[model samples]
Target: FVDVLNTMLDDTLPLTPPEWPEWGNPIESAKDFRTILSYSPYDNVAAKDYPAILAMGGLTDPRVTYWEPAKWIARLRATMRGGGPVLLRTNMGAGHGGASGRFNRLDEVAIVYAFALWAVGMAEKAEV
Candidate 1:
């Protein structure tokens, strides 16, 4: 979400001015820009153990470009002390909502559910 600001701050993006109310105008308000940075996940990565993360993104997602997740996962890997793998699954052919077909979305849901189970240590119990 925060990475989108890079584009939002740039005038070339579609809704830069409209986002000022919500995200603050980086160009116009230094205070607001600092505030946004204070809470931005990309900027807050710390050197400590973090929970398992499954950061997924769509290649064609207009809401968030695929690079956002890719960069986030990279930062996590670099800064984290010890944690479960930070996985990234980019849907090369999809957009923000993921694959178009009903069955394909189910498949995506199943993957997310499985990841949740694994994150909570439930997968091993269920496998028995």
Candidate 2:
């Protein structure tokens, strides 16, 4: 996988000590632990509504499991009454980490760029 990622970035990816271990390795620092455990995104039933975007992968992810993200997405979908876009772009091939290993996704990136432009436009028009 190093070869794959190196080809894309034209350099090696960093090997920093992960704040959260993906493979259940021993954590060496207090910064590595979340103070809260098992808090779902929509657990606060009395809170005001908020839109969300949930991106996840199904494999190689122990930190944010595929089910957790899916459940969070479902919760947002169930509670979001205003039809906000909870864009869940699943990188199933990329596993628990971010996407890589394809120039074909240039098109996907372009589409996301266009969507962002449109969103900014909508926001601007709403303010005016």
Candidate 3:
């Protein structure tokens, strides 16, 4: 996000001009830069306990780059003292929504559901 803002501020990125109205020009405005910096997840990493995480990154997701999740997980692992696992699954051949078919999505859902059950000590119940 910071990189994006910098590129946009320099008028290098295509979305800078059109997106200026919505996000403002961070390069020109300190307030805009601060606001963007405040909410950027990549910049706010801390050494604290977090819930079991299942972060998914898409190779083709234009909205959120795949490296974001990978970087986040690495940060979490390095900072977190101990807790439930922080997992990441990259879709090698998919985009933001993962694989295209209903069955494929269900597989993703099943993974999340099973993780949730295990997190709450309900995995056996789910099996039953």
Candidate 4:
């Protein structure tokens, strides 16, 4: 979502816009709320055999909740014919703004980035 904004808006929009994009409509350019939720970046995470889902949800966020990602994982987990890691990082302390604690935020970001890299087999994890 941020990637799309940074790409499309480029220099037009400020770092933190006075008013961000509204809720409901979500497609890149299709311009309809119904179409947005049915298909978009959201659907990309849906099962690709044994997809590695980096599902994160802010418990305090009204838009995206811990339950949303949990449900997504439940679907993916159900369809993963091959057993794999579907990392769910639900930050209990985070709002839509994200995690606030210093060390915890560092861990949160690292885990998410690392999980993404690890998911694609681009980075190796050390056995503990």
Candidate 5:
């Protein structure tokens, strides 16, 4: 919790002031603290079942570091009370936009489709 909040504060503080309401002024406000805490997926993970989650990340993504999704999956696996798998697929050579070429993009799309089909028990019906 502290690490994620600190990272978010560091990243967003430069673009906006601490008093900025857009992000709930997490630096020095108690009300804002509650607001941010209320909506944080990590902090508010309920002890209930969840659908299969396929989280994708890029090694060089500037906006959302790869570790965020990695940590999210870890937490989901530890806390969630479901059989649905929580998977994380990191693109080792890609950034925020993923692989650059048309064929490479299609490959990424195929992976997503494959995951979706498997999640819905339709993998056998997939033609390719």
Candidate 6:
């Protein structure tokens, strides 16, 4: 949480106008911590059954560090009651947008699509 907050403060905040109410400094709001905690997906996770989750991260993603998803999946695996095949796929050579070439991008998209199909129990139907 701190890392994400710091990133937003240091990286994203500068790009936005300070006077923008919606994008105002997080520390300036008294409800900042509470509000962020309330809506945070990581903080809200509980020991309950979940559908298959396919978390993909890029090595060079500026907006979100790869470890965030890695840690989230770790937590989910540790506490989830059942009903999941939580998976994490880290791209060794990609960034936020993914692989560089057009064909490489298509390959990445195909992988995600295949995961979605398998998650929903449609992998067999997708056979070519």
* Model 6 residue 23 distance off true place after TM-score fit, in angstroms: 5.6
Name the better of 4 and 6 by lDDT: 6
Model 1: which residue pairs collide? none
lDDT of 5 by residue, 4-111 (tens): 454545635343453355676666788777777777776766778989888888898765678878887888888899877788889998888987899988999998
lDDT of 3 by residue, 1-128 (tens): 32344444556545567787787778778998888767666566678887888888778866556776888788888888778588888887678777768998888788878888887888774472
Residue-level lDDT of model 4, residues 5-82, one tens digit each, is: 222323343432332354332333445434444544434444456656677878886544456577667767766666
What's the TM for model 6? Answer: 0.78
Model 5, residue 39: displacement in angstroms?
A: 1.9
Give all candidates' CA lDDT scores.
Answer: 0.82, 0.43, 0.72, 0.58, 0.74, 0.71
Itemize residue pairs with steric clashes in candidate 6.
Answer: none
Candidate 2 lDDT at 57 equals 49
Lowest lDDT 10-mer window, candidate 2?
A: 2-11
Model 6 Cα lDDT, one tens digit per residue, 1-128: 32334433453444333433553445556476456555566767799999988888889875567887888889889999999888888898888788889999999999899988887788874461
Q: For candidate 2, what is the TM-score?
A: 0.47
List runs of model 2 lying over 4 Å from the truth: 1-40, 45-49, 52-58, 102-112, 122-128
Error of 5 at 90 (Å): 0.6
By lDDT, the best candidate is 1
| lDDT at position 15, candidate 2 | 41
How big is the positional error of residue 33 in model 4, measured in Å on the Cα after superposition? 7.0
| N/CA/C clash count, model 2 | 0
| True-structure RMSD for candidate 1 | 2.3
Name the top TM-score candidate: 1
Instruction: List the candidates' TM-scores in order.
Output: 0.89, 0.47, 0.76, 0.58, 0.78, 0.78
Residue 72 alpha-carbon offset, candidate 1, angstroms = 0.5
Put down candidate 1 lDDT per residue, 1-128, tens digits, no spaces. Answer: 64754755777766677778878887888887788778778888899999988988889987778998899899999999998578889999889899879999998889899889978888973552
C-alpha RMSD in Å of predicted model 6 compared with the true structure: 4.0
